[model samples]
Target: MMIKAIQLLVAVFGVLNLNGIECRKSRILNSFEYTAINCRVHSASIVDFGGVGDGKTDNTKAFQKAVNHLRQYASDGGAQLFVPAGKWLTGSFNLTSHFTLYLQRDALLLASQDVKTWPVVSPLPSYGHGRDAAGGRYISLIFGTNLTDVVITGANGTIDGQGVLWWQQFHKKKLKYTRPYLIEIMHSDKIQISNLTFVNSPSWNVHPVYSSNIIIQGITILAPVTSPNTDGINPDSCTNTRIEDTYIVSGDDCIAVKSGWDEYGIRYGMPTKHLIIRKLTCTSPYSAAIALGSEMSGGIQDVRAQDITAIHTESGVRIKTAIGRGGYVKNVYVKGMNLHTMKWVFWITGNYGSHADTHYDPKALPEIEGINFRDVVAENVTMAGRMQGISGDTFTGICISNVTIGMAKKGKKYPWGCEDVKGISSGVVPRPCNLLVDQGEGIVGMCDIPADSSAIDAMELKKCSYIG
Candidate 1:
């Protein structure tokens, strides 16, 4: 029964290497059943498709074959591909619709360092040029496009990028293409990426762009404190996404909400809205726990974050934008943030100054308003707030209430830095700027944690299992 598999791939796809999943990459005869969003009419192990997880051999073909073969069951009840315990080494693999990629608890999928394993793809329409280079960029280790009802979940399985090589190339200006992320899903819907440990990603770790109905939960992302551009969980141009119960330690922002960049973003014209973030813990010495744009020109709105915890981060929540970026960031609500050792508790600025190219219109201006924060506490803070807006166009409709921040021993003399922005503050420490002092406690009513329901709340996990 284990012999005859898929129609076309069964013949040429070749050998089963359960051996690689044991003895550090050797196959072992192991089988198990697990639960997920959908049960599979058919399932197979990577070993059945020449998988050598010995930590040395390249299992790229094996992974590709397994996914491609099982994809045929999509029209029936869907399919699942199980990856057992071992050190699996591979490069890039694409997922199909109605599929699940499950890794065992001890399984470690190591990314290949060989450039040939990675295929360079064209830049995103929202960003005309590559992020780090002038042209194309490497595809992610696990990529999927135009897919639906996909799940990339495991029982604390690990996906290690081994990104030192990529990082060095980026720092030395030796690469012609931008780096690849660990997992990227584009133009898809009903995606769930959870219960995974992602480390040392080449770039952003779980990027969902132009997608919707995504649930990213129970994730642990870790990278070196100095690794460049290793952002965790960047949701770009997506809607109705919920990111919860995630822990991250990184060099960049733990969670970055973006839409697009510059004129390309303006042209793409997709705003990320109706996002719900909850129970997130982050530690990043050089960046914010949560950031919205330095690249949001497509617009961003209807964001909600609550029960956030940050330790030794640059800021608790940061909004970054620049000129020539004609977007809007509005209807943002944040509450219940417990922060420690932060450069600033809240930060919003429009002088980020990174443009896609010189041709971006200088007359373009972003609309930033309706930002609210309440029920936040912080200790060991260098400063409380840094709110800067465009010189001529001041940011308005801001409110803050029920917040307390204790400054660091040798922190900045002035706890608040404000310019070209108007807001109302109540129950804030260190006495905010005169422009924000006019409001009373009524600001709390406006900025409190909203009781509203969103589309993402309707997404529910089901009892789905695969057998082997």
Candidate 2:
């Protein structure tokens, strides 16, 4: 029955019959030519404060040696710096253009905890800023800057952050230590990261910031869901990106696509576009499996997500923008999804706010438009769904077809089968909004709204099966 359903859905949608098999074929290879790949690194492990090996635990020599080699080799083309297996402890190593850090499945890159050994960069407002004024800890376990044609791939081993100390400090003050992410990419292009176990991050796990043409595939990320600000894959101000065949169990959004600040978008003056997310599975300390912007001040559009599976997540598909996020999200295609367990099945809210309540600006909020959902199946949805549509202009050009929702639970008794949504979350319980129910047989339309709304323009449910 499941196979028959899938075939019927594919026939109805006319898209992606391959089921994401093509992605596995295109793993990052050394053949692609990009300037960032030509870096050379020091042969020995670095252990120094300022290039002086202090014996105690200084990786400065090793890190600086790799950086200097990169300055020479990266310009010619990229090259892989072989870090043989075993514990290669380091403070912080800067990433150069066109370089690959290939680990041999059994390798472990452990990080040092002593704060003084690490270096600091300029302050950014979005993350844990103003808390680490005397910045000493590394911001990323593996970091890259202004790079291209970079690949970090290996079948074995793990990059351990040893985050217990950092986690304790963050909980006590929430500002004293701003631990670096597990893997970070900033202002670079043509990046590919695959096949690594990124575990126990002090902060966000893998952050790709201000980059383009990026691919993050086939990684297993494990961070305690209770860990604060530990998002799995955060693509900030990026374009032409793809994330596939990965599994994430994190503290925050499994995959979040965002722009810049209220005016931060203007700071970079570039929006995120052309994103494709496929064959990914997620578990939570996570709020949403795949979310688009509370920080969409720079706008995010032309995104395609398919073949996603979520288990024990907060929400299945969420698009959250706020009054402060002034961008657009359109041309999205989400299909071939299998989701089980969660608070909400689908939620689209236009209200955005940071956890700290700082940096409040109204200019960031933009009208959300141009979204599509096709061939998605869900089981055991706790909360119905919330769609705000467009503020003054209705959420138009939106389509939900070939969706098979199993059940809606309401305690032990009086369980509602399925509910349709069409309403703005503004103060007055404005009548249930407009939701079209069309070509959907067996799919019942429950008109619980006592008042009237223009939200639902059509309702068609034909040749379908529903059980209440």
Candidate 3:
């Protein structure tokens, strides 16, 4: 009887085990049934389609073969094109949706230096703001279009733009080489770029324009200090961006948030919105740790920057706009920034010299509204200038709060008083009320009163730490 009972128990357990195995297999099959296939390549041993992997690399056909293979075998959907560990020298590569470029540890995708070798695609005319030192039209290096769910990820790797040749040209002229950016994502959505190093870009290192839900994190960009227009990251007319834990030591603005230019702005009709820049460090920068304008004619809104740490940067925080550039900057907040040295620790300058001798008339330009700065601790500043709440045709609804700064005096004595407040045309008057200085010895010097009584609400200074 005991033997019979044991046999029955074994049969029951066997049935349960069979059911579990069947369930597991069904799940695996379901996962495989609904997933996109991937195209994988080991970069180290890849000989171009010409079958020449002699290490003296001509990556043109090799990379084309990989891309073509992915295109052909891309399943019913798209595939992830994989690049394994090795150095791959290639020309310009285009990207598409349902595709990913994954680099493994110790991978190097080096850009070919020969300009003619790069295939040309007539992109929209760039947002032409100022001439670069390179003296040519701006071009982007890695250009993509209308792609979705694209990602560039790896453990250890680099994307070298070979911009030293381009930087040399920048020294001669300024507005040259309307060529390539290190990485350009255009008219794409859901793009993610992380965990890589971008070195020496011809133009802005990572340029993402006309995109949505973009993310860039855990990356390092190293560009020459004199490399003109080598902006670390320029997110133009993008939305829902989260850039975090990225290190940028560039010659120009570390992260410039801009829309298109005058006509370009209208055509794009897309503002850079819902941006969160956190845990970012700027070692060397020409402008603010995070800046706006110079091309903000398209308008920007719903942006927040926090937990920023900067060293040896020029401007701690800056927002600039010229006269002719008509746009609105609103719903912005900045906090938890630690800046060491800056020319203007906190600068909000309008009248951006759009036209020479046109003069800075605040009454004529569009208003910059809803700007807030709080919980910022800054030190080693030579000049702490505040150009806030200057009324032009469009200046209203701006505020600065909870700023603690340590001023570093330069050879030129710091200005004792504030700049003119009379809408630019009223000459220059020091207005008080909206301008608030919590900790600093700076004083608001001589000023003229505006004919409009409401203009007095434009400036304020409170909780002075420095007795200037």
Candidate 4:
């Protein structure tokens, strides 16, 4: 269902109720304002803390001091820090609880190029090691941990991460730690990051890990197409999150839904479940529009995505896993997608071939089931589908319906490459492989979106604003 102005807040998640009407519904999620954090009692500008926005001054201490001064009002109706219209050069700064950081229209937050500006933090317990190295990693530019009710919003302001040097260091293997992300919040709840432009990120644009009840909306992220690991949005081991009305052009996957790496993830047992993504526009020639994981050992379930648009992307959706990843991906539904200049329309692989360490158990097989895709249209496709599953542990319970794919002039002769996978397709163009046999009308209600009512159905966003 599409409304003229509505911002969804999912505290609990399962699936959307749009079945056959998924594609026909209107898309109008960008017309409204949704606030996860209410107005604060105290508000102060960065200049009040002796902050100079001269684009060369080190504003790290000023930012930290501003946050420290307003933190006392957390219980006294919270506080907000305002960044005026200027260039503020700063390093990594920790956010406080019950706080909001707002940037004016022309304001810019520039990440320092000095390595010392970034503090090193230990690797996530689930990841076991830094993604790019063996030891601790650099903290994000805007970081917070174990906090609640935080908002980082702006009036289309920009956050620029000077990442060319980091990219060069990574390519030369000179980095001893993982690159920093633009923004990251860990073990937090009721978080909102909206209405901002992020560019040239060293790594992921926004990363929410071990968090819940999060909302990310109306954001634009851009990076060089060849920049390594500059993912748009990554939600790791999170729950009940909603990402909507976002545009991204990146080197990596636009949205990478992850849990953790191999054995560490299984031991942590914190799955990323019950998430919703809608109204997304992505462009990444080398990566999928939305990827389900090469690091999902902690398991993933109840993910629903719809109203997606991709251009010059690798694939519309891809599920990646290996034998050592002993997690399960189930109850996933995607619908209402429009793709252009894609490689393969759909892809799933069990031979992802990347692991956290050598200590992983080879016998640990990931379970993939109950995946459904429908109401999609794609043009300029190279191949239709590349469905490869584990030899013995075949992926099952997949359903595709009401889809149309137009092949390019040099498209593959064999549009569908099937392996150890089985599914059913109805009303699909170019016909699927023998594994996914045509079901015609028999596929009715077989790929229905999972539906159940929880506290998320009852939750509604309240209107909030600031006068100062």
Candidate 5:
């Protein structure tokens, strides 16, 4: 009888162990299934479709043909187009859904400098006219619309926009329409752009507008300090996006988050929400390391950024908007930021850029609330903070905690400037402007604001596997 009891006990324990193994297997299987659903198995090479990367050959037709040929595989298992090492000159080209454009290490994709190569497309309906002028705009060099599961990635390949000509035209007032961006993904979902180097973009470097589920990582963008409007990685009207591990030396804001421009944005009514930005290093002597608005009217909410380092940047965190912008910027939380030689560590301006048109109502007032900055350290800062808000619509719920800033020897005469804002300050060095109420002593240095859990959960992204 004792022997029989021992056997039964062994059998029961064996069943429990099997149950544990099954649970672990289920988790592993779920992870693998998720990756398989997003993975692309089809592959092809650009050279197969008569692509010549000799720096002089216009590969526009070749690229179009290759993409067209790969459309057949989209329904099967998606396709990847591999670009070998060489300088490839091409104009604007459209990307299909479930497509991947992968560049080899030594490859340089050069945008054609000829004006005729770029076609003029209609301005965004949100912005009644082109941003620079009053007509259609030039299409982006690498443009996509209504595409899903599209990725522009490589082993740190380069895309040279050769934008000196466009910059000269803009400076000379010789352009008829707004300049084109280097990469613009519009109305798309499940987009990934990673491991690429962008140089000399005509306008913004990477713009993901009206899109969702975007992941931009391990990108290096470089532009001249004097270049115009070369903002890096603008996520406009996008949701559930993650931008991380990016290094930018930009002419404008290193990372500008926007919804739309003034009245047009108000009518379009799409908000940029649930964005996660981390591990970004930037140098923008002429602009902010990260800026919001000045064109935000549709609304911006639930933005969380951390682990940022800014060197020689004009402003660390800037919020720009005017009275005509009728949107709300709320629940922005930033932490773990380090800045050196910045004009202002924190800046919020009520009167900044002009509205897109006269249709914007002057009295439409923007709402700025729940802006939190914590665990920030700055050295050689010209000014600690400059907070400005509209008179009647004073920016409310602004919180600054655990911030320490060391002023430069020749820093601004006033370390802190405040106009019409209301908030609380805790454990901030150099004190703060009188505008912010001191929220006791022990409450300082503690971050009670919960992070956006949804954005954090989306960070479990898998890297693309290349078969070429």
Candidate 6:
């Protein structure tokens, strides 16, 4: 059956190519690209299963029944769950493998605000405790585990998590478990989430953990600037992930790439690798636009980000780690970024002290190398870069070139601050700190952009449409 699906996809690709539609060979086409490929067309509407979309009815049971009825079609060439144009009020619901969840343009998936509706699950093995608490955690609104070929795409619908109560509880220290994410897929693969709008998540908006072969594109995620832990999208301990053409306004990092916490991560030993982030526009007054980690005890490598715009953000690109994080972050590259009104255009710290537990060894030092940034322009920057490394294990092989930053009128006394790190800078504004030696004019060769890489252009998806 899978072979048949592949053959159908190939035939449709041939047709599309013949019609002057260019498709790159570097990345696999998403479900929208192969809409003409016919497999088993087993589908059901949520409203047919007694789901009320009046914005007040509890559709949790309706959703469960619909999914349960559709699970049988997993082996019958997959199934699609269609959500019509209305407000769907539901609690947590599980997804099946080989399934597609499609929402119409006027549809809204409204999360139940009642705390009892959320289920409490055990902490991730890689992290012994919840990130915000000491025990279990609340499952996400749309939760799935160990599923394959799962897709959540639509005609730019909305998933609204009324998270004000959760935020209040967190601030008052009345929460027992960690707050839930908006959408979380764990231990799954071949996943695609696009053309959606996410708002007011309790914690992270979209989290894909311990998964691979994922694509997230053309989505908008928004949260209040003061909300706690409402990161836009966090790709945790995943491989072969691509995030592109997304806009984010969040209280935390727009795109935070994390693995596990200190000692737990070192033991899990699963690194997040081969990531591509491009064409992203972000705004966060108190957080970085793109943060590699404060939770990256597992190694992170081979990351490339380009063509990004950051406005009114705290920091542009941040790499955060501590002595207890016993992993290496290497081969990171960033280029073609535009920034405005930033506290610091770039920041890397070695003294971040957030920990899940006390079991992490204080002596386990982290390693950072091969960090490169080029072709960046910024304005109203207070400080250009503040890079701090541990005393013994200095961050090495850092390179910055072809970057121009205009400081604010009341900017910091020093534009750059560096300690315990060794690197070279060329054609950089404010003449980076003395720690970075002035390499000669021919230093452009130090920055390398990956050719033939799976960037946004390589994964351009067809605009999807839905009929209500």
lDDT of every predicted structure (CA atoms): 0.87, 0.61, 0.60, 0.86, 0.84, 0.84
- Candidate 2, residues 385-448, lDDT tens digits: the string is 5666445535455555556655544521322222223322211111113453353333322211
Better of 1 and 5 by lDDT: 1
Off by over 4 Å in 6: 1-40, 452-468
Comparing 1 with 4 on lDDT, the higher-scoring candidate is 1
The CA lDDT at 154 in model 3 is 56
lDDT string for model 3 (1-468, tens) is 322343343345441232221111111110101111222221111221222322247576666655555454234444444344456677676666655565546677777777767654443443433334223344454557887766666564788888877676666654234657888898897777877898888778898888887778788998877677778888888887888889999888899998865544544556777777889999665667788876676788877788899888877666777665566677777767888877766667775654312332333354476666555677776665556434434454444444566667561254222443222111111212223332232323211111232211222212211000
Index of the highest-lDDT prediction: 1
Model 6, range 239-332, lDDT digits (tens) per residue?
8899889999999999999888899988998889989998999999999999989888888888899999999999999999998998888989
TM-score of each: 0.93, 0.74, 0.74, 0.91, 0.90, 0.90
Question: Where does model 5 exceed 4 Å of error?
Answer: 1-37, 444-449, 463-465
Residue 92 of candidate 5: its Cα lDDT?
85
Give the Å error, residue 213, model 1: 0.7
Candidate 4 C-alpha lDDT tens digits along 19-92: 21111113322222336456676666676566677799999998998888778888988887777678899999
> On a 0 to 100 scale, what is the lDDT of residue 156 in model 3?
44
> What lDDT does candidate 3 reach at residue 75?
42
Q: What would the per-residue lDDT of candidate 1 be over residues 180-258, giving only the tens digit for each residue? A: 9999999999999989999999889999999999999999999997999999989999999999999999979999999
